[model samples]
Target: MALRVLLVHQSFPSQLIAVLEALERRDDVELAGIGMNPYARRGLRYRQYSPVPVAQTGDIVIDDLASKATLAAAAAAAARALSYDGFVPDVIVAHPGWGEALYLKDLFPRAKLVCYCEYYYLRSGGEVNFDPEFPPAPPEVLHRMRARNAITLASLEDADVCVAPTPWQKSTFPAMLHPKIEVFHEGVEVPPADNRATDRTASGGPSVSFVARHLEPHRGFHTFMRAVPRLLRADPSIQVSVIGSDRGGYGAPPSDGRTWKSVLLEELNGSIDETRVRFLGSVDRRRYLDALRHSDVHVYLTYPFVLSWSALETMGASKAMVVSDTAPVRDYFTDECAAVIDFFDSRALATRILSLLRNAKIRTSLGGHAREAFHDYELTRDHGRAAWERLVTSF
Candidate 1:
């Protein structure tokens, strides 16, 4: 009989989509998926379940636990319905952060449970403390952050295996859990970016791009925006494409009820050449790739946290880059590979971007190197697709 697998995530079709699609192609594998939204694509389907609501209690920690437990309960109910339909899973792959995988083992004791261990939060070594500008995490907040690990910890104790995208991310978990964890990134696929074939430079001089999921402090939106004023003031021909939504992710939202983009724009006080800068919010993949195709250089910045998929995509696209010198980022590229700079230094960021923009020969050389380095992280390459396949089969 083919291996019966159940895929679980709060949002389906995320990192696991590659794995799911790969499994769907195999005659030896049978797959079903569970997510918050109803999802069906590429001849595969998933059952959606509403997150069961929980009444808000005054306690932050208790309310968090209660809410997750409710979600866990909902997931458990969905799995039970599947079991009733004679679809007992042999393996369960889940993103456990939302507590969806909490009771899968109870539903199918014989199944091997695999949890996507994206990031393990540490009050000191992780994101909260990495930015000095933010007020230090208070004892209560620190306690809450530590408590936030409860769901993952419980899932880990029950999980047969855990997968983290990077070695640094895997290292964040306790040393004891290291034995169960594997570093497996969902590979990105993009052609090497060479602006030579394009006639964009004739249309406009030295265009560059910036991308993030949400323009927030954690992704260094403010730093990148701060760098923009100088780039605009220095070069009259230079144009910039800033791609992403004006919301927050990972880090806390602004206390003053303004988006970070608005805050930065207000801070700049009309200093930048707004006419040259295009804020292309949440562009489609075609436009994103098109922007990359037309650009001379790309900039990516981030805190010492989970690596953004966009960063990997940028490297895979093989564009000349200005990247932040964070621990997670160092895993993919070096200073020799691209222009690496301090995350907080807006001046250096602008200077490096300006330098790469002016030099075509240097851009081509760095872009080629970036593409070569990207192979190990690509889906079709040896380490990427092969490694993911081997792991899924081994289970």
Candidate 2:
């Protein structure tokens, strides 16, 4: 008989989509969820909420009271309505970040629980990257938030297993939780981009591309903009294409009428040559794949972040990448495999871009090695299926 499974997460499709997608494919496991709706159109239905800026801070605190109330109400409605034809799961796998699991523990006490552990708060310098403009800290606020995360930690104790994406995340939990933790990567299928060929240079210039949501300061948009003039001066044959959404809306609406993207573009006005830079706002999947495949080099920069799907996508596509030498990235790729540069140093970033543009042989070599590494360490669908089987068998 198939095992019935319930998955809980406040934010569903962001990181948990891979596991959900894998579980949905199985014939032996029943999957259901109590997660945030990514495409919810109505405000009356539970809307997505984020306390910190998206993509800016990884360690975020969702308002626990609101989340608990939402989950409890949903559970009550599910029980009264006999949702899913009175189906009760035997096991539960949830990402316990947003305190949605608090009510779930009571709702499904008999089911074996499994939690997805993303990160734990620490006091180290790398813990907080505060912005002076819209400051996220005074230490006290973080302390309160950490206390709220404790609710999540407590909920995980009820879990029979913990799924983690990286060693960095697995190590964050207590040693007792370690015994139950399993390491996995939420992987992406490499879209068919390797077959398509495109012009490497646009109008006698090297074609470079950047893929990220247009959030300021975090994804290193400002830093990349700073490096552009230097890069253009060094090699006149270079053009850049940035791909992302232009809407100013974040976790919620901005009180001010301007988005960070518009602000940055306005700030860099005449300094940037419109002919050399193109802002292709929110391209379709095919266009995104084309952008990655056609580029001579892919640039990624972040301040002490866990791995991004875009970074892995670039690797999967075998595009040469110039990545930031932060802890999370350095943990995986050694200096020999990728072009590493310090996040704060624009000169170093510009220099690396220039070097990669001038040498096609070195670019090809790095791209080859990166694809090999992706197959070895990053692909997760098969591994995730096996892990799900083990978790179900134990029950």
Candidate 3:
């Protein structure tokens, strides 16, 4: 009999898409999914579930917990129906961050449960209060943050195995559960060099680039924006491309209902020339990779939390970088591969960006090292393939 597998997530397979595709290529495996985005991957039977409404609402903290509980109950009902219909999976994999996987084991007692353990909340020593500019989060907000992780903690009780994308992320979980968790990144395909060409700079000057899912404080957009004027002061001929949506993803939303982008732009008014800066709002994969190829210097800054895939892709593409020296980056980035800087220091950031652009020899040398580092840690590379395969079999 084929190996029957089921994948679950609140939305699309945020980090599981590659795993889904890999499993689909095997004739010995059968695949299915339960999520909000059924079309994210092909060759899988999918069932969609929506959040059950909470009738009573009071404190934001209480309401949030009730909502997650409702989602878990609703999803459990759906899974029970699937079992009744004769789709009994041998193994179940889920990203249980949103509480949807809370009762899966109860519904399928025989199936081994493997969870994608993304991040565990901490009062300090994590992303919570990393930025000093934002006043300490209120007591109620902190309570809600811990409450949010209740489902993740609960789901771990029965998980046969758990996967974390990075070592730093895995460390955030309680020490007792460390034995059950393994570190594995969802790999990226490196496009052939000849397939894409670098974009030509208008003035023949070096170009710097930044890419993120959203221009939010958690990823250090404010720090990047603050460094721009000083960067232009040092190298007026250089151009910059900022790629991402103007919305908050990890951090709190903007107070005035304006995007972090808009607030930063307003603060930068009349100081730096807008002509030198181009805001390429959230491009597709092809364009994003092209941006990495064309960039002379790439800047990535983030808090002490889950690392972004773009950072790894930039390294894979062999782009010179000035990266923030934070916990998430310390695992894969170092002085040898890129210029490491403090997340809060705008002056130091500008100085490093200027230096990299001015020296082509150093840029190429560091970029070569960056690409080498990618192959060293990247799952898509040959060296990591066997380990990734072993991980799947273990699950």
Query: Lowest summed lDDT over 10 consecutive residues: which window, candidate 2?
Result: 41-50
As for candidate 2, its clashing pairs are 206-237
Global Cα lDDT for candidate 1: 0.81
Q: What ordering of candidates by lDDT runs from best to worst?
A: 3, 1, 2
Segments in model 2 whose C-alpha atoms lie over 4 Å from true places: 38-84, 125-127, 130-136, 174-176, 193-204, 246-257, 266-269
lDDT by residue (tens digit), candidate 1, 1-395: 88888888878868786677667778898788888887886644467788767788778778878888888888888888777877889888898887898998988999999888988888666787888878877776776666668888998899998888888889889999999998878776665556472225444677888988898988998899999989988888888988999875777778888898888899999986777888989989888888877777889988889888777777776678999998889888887669999999999999998888778777877777887787755533335556656777887
Total clashing pairs for each candidate: 0, 1, 0
Q: What range of 10 consecutive residues in model 1 has the weakest lDDT sum? A: 194-203
| Model 3: per-residue Cα lDDT at residue 211 | 88
- List clashing residue pairs in candidate 1: none
Off by over 4 Å in 3: 40-42, 192-200, 381-389
TM-score of each model, paired residue for residue:
0.95, 0.82, 0.94
Per-residue lDDT over 1-395 for candidate 3, one digit per residue giving the tens place of the 0 to 100 score: 78778888887666777667667777887887888654645667777777767777678899888988988987787677677777788888888888888999988888999889899998988998889898898998899989988878999888999988889999999999999998878776764432122334767667899988999989889899999998778776788889998865888888889899888888888665778888899899888877777788899999998898888878887778999999999999999989999999988999999888877777777888887888888646333344444666564
The sequence of per-residue lDDT tens digits that candidate 2 reaches over residues 110-193 is 878878887765545343543233555567556655765676687787777788887766776677778888887766777544
lDDT at position 10, candidate 2: 63
What is the C-alpha local distance difference test score of each model? 0.81, 0.66, 0.82
Which pairs clash (backbone N, Cα, C closer than 3 Å) in model 3?
none
Please name the candidate that would achieve the greatest lDDT relative to the true structure: 3
